[model samples]
Each structure stands twice: as C-alpha cells, then as structure tokens.
Target chain A: MLRALRNHHGEPSVRRPLFSPVNLAKAIGALTVAILAGVLLSGGTFAYMNSTVALPSATIKAGSAALTTTGTPLVLTGLYPGQTQSAAFTINNTGIVPLVLNVSGVAAPAADANSLSAALTIRVDVTTAAAGCSILPGTAGWQGTFAATLPTANAPVSLNSTLAAGATATLCLSASLPPSAPSTVQGGTTKSFSVTIGGVQS
Target chain B: MTRSRILSSARSRIGVAVGLVAFLVLVGSGTAQATWTTLSSAQPATASATTASVLLSDISALNTTYNYTGTTSPLVIAPATLQNTGGAPLTYTLTETNTNATLAAKIAVWIWLQVSGSCGTTTVGTAGTLAAIPALPAGATSGTAGQSTVVCIATQLTGTILASSGSTLTANFTLTGKVGANWQGTDPSSITQSVFQAADVTNITCSTSGHGSNTTATVSWSLPAGATGASIYVGSTLVLPDTSTVSFTATKANVGSATSITIKANYASGVQSAGVVQALDSANGSGCG
Candidate 1:
C-alpha cells in the first residue's frame, strides 16, 4: 500500500517512519490475533470429548468417643477385719466409637486411728452375667492391697476388653480386710479412699 | 523500567498465591488425621473401718473380806456396775479361778443382774454362776455402748462345812468381753474373798450334736439336782419350753449364724441356773443351718 501511494504521488513521497502510531496499532492487533489463534489450537489438541455425571455429594462425619458409668462413687461403711464388702456398677460406651476402659485408685489420708487403709485390700472383677457381681464369673482383673494396686492416679489398671458403641459392662469392686489384720485396727473408724474409671478410643 | 516493574509484580503475586494454596492443603491434611479421645467423669469410691472396746466402773466394790461362822449360810457382797464403754455392744463371760479347790467345790458363787433392788434380793435375775459348777456358762450382755448393768455377787454354802475354823476361800473373777463375733482380751475384775462352806452344788451340762448343713440339732443336757424342769435357748430365743425331758431336738435357725448354744436348768424353788453354752460345729454353714 505504501508503494501504490508513492506511485500515485508521481515523485517518491516522503517515507513515513516504520513505527508510526497507525503502524504500531496495526502490528499489535496482528500479534494479538496470532497469539489467540495459537492458544485455541493448543487447547483444542489437549482437550478430550467428555461428559460428567454428578455423583451424590460425598458425605463425611467424624465419630465421637465417650463413656459413662452407673452407680458410681461406691461408698462402703462398717468395714471390719476378716470381712469383705462388694459393690456392682456398670460402664456404658456412650459414644459412636468403641472404647477401652481403665481404672485407678486414689486413697485419702488414713482417717482411722489404726490406719486401716494400709491393711485394706481391693479386688476388681468384670462379668457379662446379668446377675451382676453376685455371679463373679470371670477371674479378677486386680487383686491386692489398696496401697499396692492404686498407688497413684497415673497408675491405671486396664479392663482388658474393648467395649463397642452402646455396649455395657458390669464390674464388681470388692474391699476386704484379712483376718491377720493388726489388733490396732480394732475400733478404728473413717478410713477412706476413692476409685476412678476412665475410658479411651480403642 | 516501567515494563520491568510490571513483570516483577506479576511474579511476586504468583508466588504469594502458590504459598497460600500450599498452606491450605497442609491445614486440610492435618485436620483429617487428628485423634479423638474421651474420658469418664470422676467417679469416687470410699470405705471405712470400725473398732471395739469396753470399760468397767465401780470395780472396787468387788474386792471384799467375808468373815464366816459355823451358822453362816450365804453372804451377799457389795454390788458393782459393769459398763459397756466400747463403741459396740458386747456380751461378757465370767470365769472364776479359786485358789482353794476344796472350798470351790463346796461353795457356789452366783452373779446376778440387780434390777432396782439391793444385793441378795430375790427379785434380781441370776446371770450365771462364776465357778466351774456349770460347764460353759454364758454371762450377761452389757448391751450397747455406754450402757450399764448392776451386778450382784452372792456366795452360798452348798453342803455342810467339814472344817469349822481355819478354812478359807479366795476366788478370782475374770470378766471377758466378746466383741462382735470374736472375743477381745480379758478384763480381769477379781472378787477376792474368804468364805465358809456350802451344800452340794447343782450342775447343768449341755452338748450339741448332729448340726451341719441341716437346720435341726440334737441338744442333750444332764439335769441338775433338785431341778424339776429345764429350758433351752439358742440365743435369746427359747427353742424348748420348760420340760423335764433332758434331751430334745431344737431348730438350729434360732442360733442363726451364731455358734453359741445355751441351756438353763429350772428348779422347783423358782430359781433358774445360768446358761451352759456349747459351740456349734463350723460345718453348720450359716443362716438356717
């Protein structure tokens, strides 16, 4: 087009600069079209013909772990040497996940004049029987003096079984004083202690 | 320079966007792997032990000197108070050890509970004989703690005195308290005295047999002299009504889980001898047996 313009003007018209505003605009437009065409061709080559069926939205929820006890905080009174007192309680898995149970003992200061807590022994037994601790069917999980079995809170005795969600287990706790208990224990009163039940995700 | 600055800003923005995406990814993964734990509420357990004790007051009245003559029949000594000082109720057994065996055989010492009456009064009920005249005699109970029961001691001549002048009798009474199911140590309260003589002593002896897992036991006893009837007791309950028959069948349930069996000899003079206790075999488990 520039040559035709020069010929129409008869003599060689003054040559315009190669980067004039109009020329620059025309060059930029051409480059933009070329880049756009290249991008479309590449996208077409990589793309495959496909269809999507929306699946039911995937749903996810977290399971909870919890535990509860029935007839807790057993209080025993009028304990004497050569005597055994037993209490029955239930442990229920109150959450959605299975849980493992554990027990620990915390002995209070010896309130009795004779320190009867030292001579007291504790026994824990677990059973599936409906008659409860009266039918102590299984072997004892723990059997020893209170000082030995529950020396501290960190020391926990395992129930040795997993409880499924909503399942319940019956436990029997027996406290006894051997006949050989010291004579000083006679007339002693108010020796106290506590037992705790704990649970964790299995 | 302006174009170079534009390129630098674009690169910086891309780096920031990349970092933000990485942080979100990491956070998402951490939340998925977390563990869940739950514990039970604090459940408390408690226990306690009990003790037993006893106390005797006004014990000085028991020690006395008794002067006797040929015509002296029986002497009633001063009355003393037996108190249950311990926390629990207690039953007691009194055993008399006499230095003079001859005088002990001829003399009968009777300890009775004085109820609103003086010593030697016929209204007072006889608890039991202290001497070995009746084998295995059961003593009176002191009841609950802080309860007091007035006790009277009387010495009677069972037969005619052979030696008139120099005969002396010294009796030591040892009261032992049975606390709960077992006996604590002995509380020795002595009644030292010099006595004359007595007539033939009446004795009652009882034995229990055929007691085991079954509820029935065969109780047999030797009738005391001049006794027209006898009454048997397993505890406070009377199993056999007053009768002349020396041997009879009684229910072991009356004894419950207790092992003590006592029998009383009823005399025509309206006097009843102390209870003679016999221990039931351990084979008789507990309860009805």
Candidate 2:
C-alpha cells in the first residue's frame, strides 16, 4: 500500500498540449529554412580559378579655367563737384584650374573736352564679401586708384592673389571729383568707363 | 522598445549612413577626370570727356619665314602694331592680359625694334634684337604724330615652331602708355592677336624609280635650323619620319603614277612650320608597259 502511494503521489505529472498539424509544419519549415541558409552561406559548392588578372591603368586629367562676372555694370550719375559714389560687382571662377586675376580700368571720352573722368579721382576697393556689393566676408585683398586717362587704360594690377577653382570675390569701386575741381567739368557727363579683369594660370 | 531592438535599429541606421558616405566618395573621385580648358570674354565700359585720344589701331597678325640660313637663332614675327595718335609723348607698357595659360607657357611675347628697315623677303635687319616686355629698353615711345610701331614678338615653343599643325593661339595684349605730366589723360590701347606660329619651308623634292608593280619613293626637304622633326603626306596618307627625309614603298594602287604630297616640319614647342607641296612619280608597273 505504501509503495502504491509513493508511485502515484511522488511521480511528476506530465501535461502535454494537444499537438496541431499547423504548429508542427511551422516549426519544421523554420528549421529547414535555417539549415538551407547555413549551407548556402558556408557549405555551398563554389570554385575560383587560381590565376591573376591585370586591369588597365587609369589616367588622370586636369580641368579647365573659367571665369564669369555677376551683377550689373557699375554706373554713376548726377555728377557735381566733389561728389563721390560707390558701386560693386562680383567675379567668380567657374573653371577647375586656379588662376591669377589681372584687373585694369579704361576711361572713355566724354562729350566735353574736360569730362568728369579727367576731373574725378577714382578708387577701387576689393574685398572678399559674403555676396556681391555686400559686407566683407574675409580680409580685404586689393585696393588701388584708377589712373587718369581716356582711351589709355590703367596698368594691369594683379589682384595680388589667386582664385581657386570655384571661388568668388567682390570688387567695390568709389569715384569722386575732388573739391579742387577745374571749372571744365561743370555741365558734362563722364563717358562710360570700361574695366577688364583677366585671368591666367598661376 | 527593448534595448536589443533599439540597438538593432541603430546599427541599421549606421549601415545606411556608411553606404551613403561610400556613394559620395565614389562620386567625388569621378570629378578628377575633368579637363582644364581656357575661356576669355570682354565687355565695354565708357569714360567720356576727351582731348586727343590714343587709340589701339590694330593687332595685325604677321608671319616670318623660318630662315634656317639666317643669323637669327629663331624667327620673329611682328603680330601687333600700335600707333600713338594723341598729342602727348607717351611711354608704353604691355600686359599679356588674357591667353591660354598652357599655350602662354610655351611662347614668349617681346618688344622688338625694327632693325632700322623692313623685314621682307631679303631680311634687311643686320641682326634681330629681342626685348622682353614689361620693361621696354628704349621704352616703346610713340612719336608726337600718329607714328605706328610694330610690337614684335619672338615666340618659342617646347619644340620647333612650324606649320599649320600648331594650335591657333589667341593672345590678348593691352598697351597702357600714359604721360606722367599733368592733365595728360592715359589712353589704353588693347588688341588680340591670333598667332598661327607657322614656319616657312622651301626647296622640297620627291622622286621614285623601279619598274615593279610597287615602287620605292624617296622624299627629301630642308627646314629651318630649329626644326625638330618633319612629316610627309602622300595624298591623304601621312608618312611619319624621325629625320628630315623619308622613303616609303608605294603600291601602284595606293599612290597613283604620280601623287602630290605636302611635307611639314615640326619646331620646338609644337610649332608647326608651313607645309611645302611636292610631286612624286611612281615607277611604271608591268601592266603599264
């Protein structure tokens, strides 16, 4: 009687859920997929030839040098004795090569023999600005006075610097007829002034 | 979300960021293949109120025969001429404003004084005088009247300056000769010269002998002293040469009984001298007989 009691009470009872075909199939499919992936990754049949190949060498080339100017041409009107006005323009290096810029100014002849160009003192102030005709973004680079002459242009003065590929700089010009003006420019308009900025490889 | 799931999402985002960085690196490497080209443009600005104006009258493109026999080491051409029409006596300064930098590096522009007379077929100058610009020795002074001055240039190439094969190099020059005196307005004269850089070739002869279906032809020519190499073209086909003369076996079918060919010489710095035309007579084939 004691042995029957020990066998019936002391034995741990095993509770099994009802086995379903769907669960069995799902588990089997998951295990099969895992095994197939493992075989494909590390146990697949693959072969490679024990030979070498030589690829053709590549050549490198340099890019072009290009420059462009933005903003309207500098214009100043309503002339009087000792009147000073300032205008600004932007120069952009659009090419791939670095270039040294050369700037020159030319004064065109006015209708009167003694136009404002002869009577006026012109100064060009160049600074690297955030944008055209805006405040300075960097250090001031170049500043010079335009020579007094018409038909004859100013000497080419280097920007004293270089513009790297894809860089921009701004030029500001201020013109004034000094208070000590000769009576010659009283009622005449100054001829248009032409300025050329040229670039050469540095 | 669980820590593991969050960590897994982070790793996925890192992988995506790495992929994007790799793509950008590839694109940056592709930009290295771009070639450097040159560009030049101009705009007009006016300055009125004039007295006597000094105008940039001409940028004449001139030529010179590669006189190998001449005393000058290299030939010179006066491609630009400047005249001072203004009343003031002015001192002239030249600035090579714009040019193809690669081409500019190969050539040199100078202020040349006419050896007193004309540089025509006879070469009247006793000896050629070359002066580098920026500092004109006898400063290129304009006469009181509108006297014209030749802006002579002696161009040098990495090799010989020869014929039409050389690149058409456009050199822009600006002359600023102003009087320092009071009330003297400085006038700027500017011009652009397209220098062809061609050398002259003379006395080229060609001949062929042999009665076979194919004949060997001989061609010989003379070039200036500075000539580096020459090329001979028979009809449309070019016969390359390392020396001054070249001989080639010509088939009757390829080069007719007689063919007209042009021979051009190569100068230092890739300047190609002018080409000379010569006639080549092939041997009479057996069929012709």
Best by lDDT: 1
The whole-model C-alpha lDDT of candidate 2 against the native structure comes to 0.51
- Model 2 stretches astray by more than 4 angstroms: A1-62, A104-107, A110-114, A130-155, B1-40, B43-289
Question: After superposing candidate 1, which stretches have Cα over 4 Å from the reference?
Answer: A1-59, A70-72, A104-112, A127-138, A149-155, A160-162, A167-170, A190-192, A200-202, B1-38, B53-94, B97-102, B108-159, B162-172, B177-289
Q: What is the interface RMSD of candidate 1, in Å?
A: 11.5
* Candidate that would win on DockQ: 1
Docking class of 2: incorrect
lDDT of 1 by residue, B221-263 (tens): 6775666677776667777768787765544454556665567
Interface RMS deviation of candidate 2: 15.0
lDDT of 1 by residue, A139-159 (tens): 667677755546233676776
